[model samples]
Target: MLDVEVSSLGPGVIERALGCLRNGHHAETDVPYATLSSLLERAVEAQASDVHLVPGYPATFRIHGELAPVDGEALAPGDVRRMVEAILPERVRGRLETERNFDCSVAVSSGGQSHRFRANVYLAQGNWCACLRHVPTEIPTLEWLGFPDALAARLASHSNGLVIVTGVTGSGKTSTLAALVSLLRRDASLRILTIEEPIEYLHPVQGGSMVTQREVGRDVDSFADGLKYGLRQDPDVILVGEIRDRETAQMALSAAETGHLILTTLHTRDAKGALTRLVDLFPQDQQDDVRSQLALSLRSIVCQHLLPSAQPGQRRALALEVLHNNLAVQVAIRTGKIETIESAIQTGKREGMFLLDEDLQRLVSAGQVTLETARRYASDPAAIKATKPAW
Candidate 1:
């Protein structure tokens, strides 16, 4: 014999009661308006780069290259999903549901002060997960980002050819790129167009450059689309947010070949890796064509990383591979002698070019960062001791 539970409610009553329970009792079932506002406020207060809402965990904010959980109750999966849905537009929600992910910019305001957040909401572990990156109201210059004067000057003076900034994720690529764009913005005569998946830094027209930001999924469907349209826009400079695929890579190369100064980022560990990554993006049959175009249009590659400084703050450093497309380097690229390119970078220190290990050694010598940390993140730890300068 089994005991049966009885409900003293009708069909409609039961349905309403269940809905109320789902809304009010489940921790992850919905995100309340008050909670969402508070989270955004906390993010701003802490100067966080990103705010993450995850199920079964407290809200977390990434500040100064570290993720710390906000002092609050853990969120329920359903609650986070509902909260995320409330902030999104109906069309965005519809698209997200249909496509399983969505990307867009969301502006939140309190007391007349507005901050823009680049939001990416996606399905994860059968629940909605959202990450919001804060975008500063004003663009930062190279000085503000702590770039050396020599490097800043070189970036501003480049007339044509490609400039690649390579780094791992959360390594300050966007900030560095923003600084470069800000420098160019001071020039009122140059027309600059940027294609980003979600525009992080907003640059205003100033001096000689007229700045235009096109966001993927908002202004255009893809990077390739934006790149294709950018060619006919009478632009003197182009910034591709990231070269993730061959189409955008080829488009960037084409843009550089046509006398447009192109700036882009790649997720590579070091300068040599940046070159290898670009070449490997193409099919074998197209390797020769890619090598030819790259050798001709290549200008410089700045591979950088952000490490926790010894002074209780984070610092950005560079492991640059500055290829001026000289005969030897061009021959190396064309003839598949990429290993020699590493040697060139090692010996090209006089030309403002240095390898990752060299930069790490400088940082360690300056007491900016520890040798252990540098070695942990370095592309080749063995190269560190070999490249260290004599005290």
Candidate 2:
């Protein structure tokens, strides 16, 4: 049953390694390094979200938010290095040598379908360790990612404004952003320019819209520089991968103000935090001015979290909070009254605004997730009670 067909590696090697899954065969320490590719192929077949390769440990996969070790011998330091070299791109080799940390993507095609993985290889305890996250080749729709269709379309229908997607690491931010890009592609005349650290989902020309993508280290020097030159390329919409620094944030706002739709992501826990984090990146003296720019150019904020699901066949459920820029929200941002933003979201439900805690409660009430699961991740635990829930 373990003789899985794979196109990315030699048939003999694939069959041998996969057969080990059932036969309990362990890799020899001195053998040629053919198991790495086979391991990746198997990881994909299993639908694992991530693969971990570390020295002195067996290969591991993260499935359904849990880590499980593969049935193989522990990898030596030398084995880990060989595995890294097998998939590491030639262009990033120099950067890895100098900085000892880098981000890249690798593609493994099987049966005419391409599967991409976002990889980060870095030095830990004087040895190289790597984490590879699987990225699906075809972009999923917004609804499939667990966004309300009406709300998702409203966020995408805007021709010119800033839309921010905030979430913690491994919370599906990149996939959600890519889904938004796919929605905008329905218009043939719009030109989309995406600057990603390592391009994840490849976008081909669709619906007549021109899609141009650039990688940070490979295609462009940095996100800021990409935005600087991308504006000159006559793009109607720009996707800045993540606003990591002040320059990128400032440039994104400027692009939004100047009649271009700017889409980006922030590492924040909630919608209100997204605004505060962006303003905090600027100097104290200039924060007020940045706040003014943000208030004017902001369109909406969508924050999300993935919690373990109670339903069978569904590994995780998406808990989302959304804030659409209205007069009250704009005033709050302008005056730096960050505390009032939450209240605004509570009252703006008719306008598609919802708080994270409320959504968590909804998920619990509907039995998509358990009460304990919702309580564990709720921003305001007290708001998530057992008596009744809010939609």
Candidate 3:
């Protein structure tokens, strides 16, 4: 029932696919690449964040962070494998076979607009499966996204030092950084260089700033290599996709010390967690040096986490904990008082540092988020309840 011919597949195919899954029968041949492409088209049309392909299941899309089945038939393991192969270029197929997993970016066109996707192709239960995150075609400015304006201006005003926008996966860290870069382009006249793996949001160099984007494994070998050579590229601002390893972190600090503003991301829970993760990346013997270097060269760390907004349409809003490296903050870092960092942030609001709970409370009070949702994600729900958002 799920084996409807690609040419003949049409209305009501989703029901057919679900029935096929119940009966445990699927066409074992290669589904047309256009089949998956059509699913992607539908996903983008629906503003889905990700598309997932798994064996013995229908294609699914992550709409507003929730998974929903795409309008299609259930795919057999072989069918999924073929779908993966169909999307991947032949040159990368060998790497997939040898490595069992690969990361790549692809561009899909639908409705006369091009949408980008970062693809993760991996083996699941010995069957090829893939997860694709839909990257927006246009790079958004902070103002356009309605991110905190003061914070965006502060991040863009930095001429030197390292600024990190940190969060867990699907937390919109990349989009945040991209917006910062766009703001910098509008507010300052500087050359901005970015190094990303397979470059996600293609920012067209515009306004007063010049943007030169390099792709890891394509334009350069790795983040370290691009960052090291970026120092000599006469750039005033550098954006490294993520501080993924010790080597990349070292180079990022080096660039920051050498008078280049380094913007990057780290997969951490909050600003304090980011500092701990950065220092812990180095060996114990080198941690003190890292902390010292970080104390001076760290400009700001904005930790972002998303929560379900009040919009019944499954939308999400950002809650941020912003940390600026002022003198008091620097002293805390230099003294290795990671425990006291949170306290410093609580009192440093005039300098643009605040806790996540503060932002969450603000959202709730503004009617952008519900009180229950805020409590679920807030750092101090009791405190928020006692004293309402002052914003």
Candidate 4:
């Protein structure tokens, strides 16, 4: 049976109280806040990517793609609700009540250092639940994120056109986008602007470029609004956190067409699917225009997948499809010959473009990853074997 705690004080206070108790210290008041803080500290210590607070279950932490329940009594629905509500601001609480779901940013301090979190609080099974994703304090570099040197170099030097990083949730899309933005920042003379929903990574203007990051709800109403204003900001580089709607997509294409380098992400399975999704986002009447714009402004598409490494207790490896815009590829896009893009990628190795299968095969041949794992994620298994080493 789950433990039930009746507390009107709220989850934040409860968390702090728990933290104090867990740390062998006592709090005079606000026991809930201490408890919540302690839970977060434990999650950080365990290197968890996300912490889940759900009704009828023990608090859970996701570490390396697996969820483990914290060793404690399960929480009742009321306790979960109170804890979640306590952390949210009044405005966010009002929005959650109206919308039944809310996305907000949370900052917590520990050991005199602050950590940021992207939180999604929603109603599940008629009970309030929350999931918190940890946001790193500093932007990660390409090498730090384990991207290939050649691929990172290409993304850094592309002066104009659109470059997209596509992946599903938790696939490190944001990390890759941050790496590219960081690379551009090193160029000193560039002006960069980014629009994100609940802004995850915060980049400091270290070298040449001046960067401005805007959050969707805080700085702007929507992704389209940011893109609309981004054009007038005189930015050399524009980073759209996600191409969510048709208006934003059109805006991104226009930015690319106007000679500004645009970087963004999408949720897609593969490189071919990424292009198809972009073109399909518009109405049939506008698709032709979208295709033309895309063909002209498309620079590169990098589709990444994170796979658990063969070695235990190690980080995941990224398999990527690096697509560069060339004449044949552009023609394929303009003519709606999306199927031909894969063959073009296969033959365009000399031109710095690589299909996902090619990258998987290289990893398998080098013994960095297994052929079985490569086949599981490959778009075409037959193509993967062609790159295998001879026994």
lDDT of 4 by residue, 180-269 (tens): 888878865888898988788888747767999998887899999999988898999988999988889988999899999999999998
Could you give the C-alpha RMSD of every candidate to the true structure, in order shown? 8.7, 4.6, 4.4, 5.6
Flag regions of model 1 displaced more than 4 Å: 1-31, 313-324, 382-388
Which is the better candidate, 1 or 3, if ranked by TM-score?
Answer: 3
Q: Give the better candidate number (3 or 4) by TM-score.
A: 3
Query: Candidates 1 and 2: which is better by TM-score?
Result: 2
By lDDT, the candidates rank as: 2, 3, 4, 1
lDDT of 3 by residue, 1-391 (tens): 0112233346664454445434544333234445565677778879898999898778898887678886556677666655555556555667766887777887655555666788888888898888989989788777655577788888878999999999889899899888888878887789999999768888885787899999887689899999989888999999999988899999999889989999999999889999999998899999888999999999999888888768877568888999999888898888899989999998898998889888888888778788888888776677665345456
lDDT (Cα atoms) of all candidates against the true structure: 0.75, 0.83, 0.80, 0.79
Clashing pairs for model 2 are: none
What lDDT would candidate 2 get against the real structure? Answer: 0.83
TM-score of each: 0.87, 0.91, 0.90, 0.89
The global Cα lDDT (0 to 1) of model 3 is 0.80
- Write one digit per residue (lDDT tens) for candidate 2, span 277-340: 9999999999999999999999999999988888744667899999999999999999999999
> Which residues of candidate 2, in runs, are more than 4 Å off?
1-33, 387-391
User: Cα lDDT for residue 112, model 1?
Assistant: 59
lDDT of 4: 0.79
Span of ten consecutive residues with least summed lDDT in model 1? 1-10
